[model samples]
Target: MAFFLILFVLLLLLPDAYVWLSFVRGTSVLWSVLWWLPSGLALAALGAAAAGWFGNGLVRIFFFVLLCVAVPKLLFTVFSLLGRGIGTFVHGAAAAGHVAGIVVAVAACGAFLYGSLYGWKRLVVRQTDIVAADLPEAFDGYRIVQFSDLHVGTFGRDDRFVRALVERIVAAEPDMIVFTGDLVNASAAELDPHLRSLSRLRAPDGVYSVIGNHDYCEYGPHGSPDGAELDFEEVKRRQRELGWDVLLNESRTIRRGTDSLVLLGVENVSRPPFPSRGDLRKAMSGVGAGAFTILLSHDPSHWRREVLPETNVRLTLSGHTHAMQFRLGGFSPCGWVYSEWEGLYREGDRMLFVSSGAGGTAPFRLGAWPRIEVLTLRRGTR
Candidate 1:
């Protein structure tokens, strides 16, 4: 926590200094004060949060305020640097650059506001078709609705969003519903308010889910390891109450007529800095080698790290990336961290689908809008 706080402070200072030197230093006293006042307050909030003086709710508010203040400053700094570099070679370039920076900062402020107010609530549905030679003939044209990274704490007690989401999924009339994970941001209590709304979700086959990194209760204030464990159990119990089959490193077989397919779900798994509790071997123990299988693992990294090299799981579903909740022209900084960040990725006969996520810890989404995925399984080569 201390390391991250220091890093965030450094990030804020760099842009704050750049913008002051380039634009506010020589401006009116009013302009300078206006610039430094919010920056000071943001830093103070950061210190309070790091010192544990604020509660979870206050910390979240501080984070949102920090983003509002920092993002525009960062944008202005980038444009200001470009302008200064150009000013060395061209006349009036620096002045024009300053104007551009201001314009960009204003636009960023508007975008952040809009993203917070409307973008996160604007749920979009994406449809994908998966064709595999190994798919069961009876399961052809099976429509599965996949939603992930719900982060229910973002909604507080409001069931409106979940109700709307459930309505949308029900209207689609999918054969099955699969949730990739991150059902809550930290604790099981977050799921309480939306239990009724979420329970409305139904499918002919069943609703299946697997845990995500956040479901472990380690990211938030759980008091102790025992408390975290209890909270985790409560999360699973609530999901089961909602009629969801919470698969924890387990497999289930779905039979249609004489044809059958395997559905394997594992606990959260990821490379370092994140937890890796999934045991793919254990999940597949009783399954036949040739059975067409769909694996639900929270992190997309698990698909390449274990599934591809070790198992014949034909299709993998995941939702941990969230595209950092920001994207432009099909690109995001999340790509720098996750090789298969969003959308469908295929390697030979195996495939993985990563959702941009239906909800998140922060109530914001830019070009990477919250989404629900409708995938159709077809029994043929594409």
Candidate 2:
């Protein structure tokens, strides 16, 4: 009970603290700086009111924002302390705050606008040919076209981009195509109009997918929000309607004359102690320990925990971080947020590649552009 009381107080105070620090502290000199601080605080209040649920841990982004809100303010304080004495601290701090706000406001706003314009200008389709064999013999050079996070209902509700995205993927004529996850932003309800755009995708081998955390939020009754009111059953139904073979702790085998490639998929995972929804053990149930395998995982951490140590999955494909929806620096941009924001990584014998994702969500992005990837996996003599 005491713990609940303390959390309730923090919940109430977090937003107000943000309000005071943003608007009241800066004296209106920093517009962009003040706007986003409370945007996150507001999101937190909504999340908290929704119960600050942790079944997904996605909502923690708001709290993450609350922490980043202080970065600019703290940067100002540090600059002021460096330049002036104790007597001049207050005045210098205010001036420094105003300056930092303007600089950050311009930088962030510029990047945001640029990203938006970039998203609409053209949604480029990348074609990749994957070859997962060491010798150019069995299945020498294989092509795997990948579609990661398309928040499907994003970028001005534009259907044309989706159509173009599919068109490009189809044009590549990939032997196989896989959608790692984040097929939609909030729910399947927004997908009806976007369905045709999705229908454009076709690969001779097949198109398969795994559920992203967003899908869970929309389909399942969010354990946090109103007892997970989202229609999960409907989400899965829609995935089938779109012609995707959604895999949940399941494996599919893709074949050519005498060779077969195994594709195993599971639910989204960001950190550890994940639920055993289609764990490696069950997915690879009856295979010879050395079967060539490709796992369509939604998060990269799964590679380290399940794929690398436990299973024989040589490659894992995933995309949930969205590079934090914005890339920020040379000094640990990932430190500001979650790990594994973007790109390919290696963990011992296993290889994991994280797509930059395919679209924006909620109309905000910075630094990183939207992307589509073509992974040409060849069996290298490692």
RMSD of each: 2.3, 6.0
After superposition, candidate 2 runs with Cα above 4 Å error = 1-101, 116-138, 155-157, 218-230, 270-276, 328-332, 335-339
Off by over 4 Å in 1: 1-7, 21-34, 48-56
How far is 250's C-alpha from truth in model 1 (Å)?
A: 0.4
Please give, for residues 77-186, the per-residue lDDT of candidate 2 as tens digits: 44443444433645565566556655764564455455544533345555444434442355566778887877765543567777778877887777778998877665
Candidate 2's TM-score: 0.73
The lDDT per prediction is 0.88, 0.64
Determine the backbone clash count of candidate 1: 0
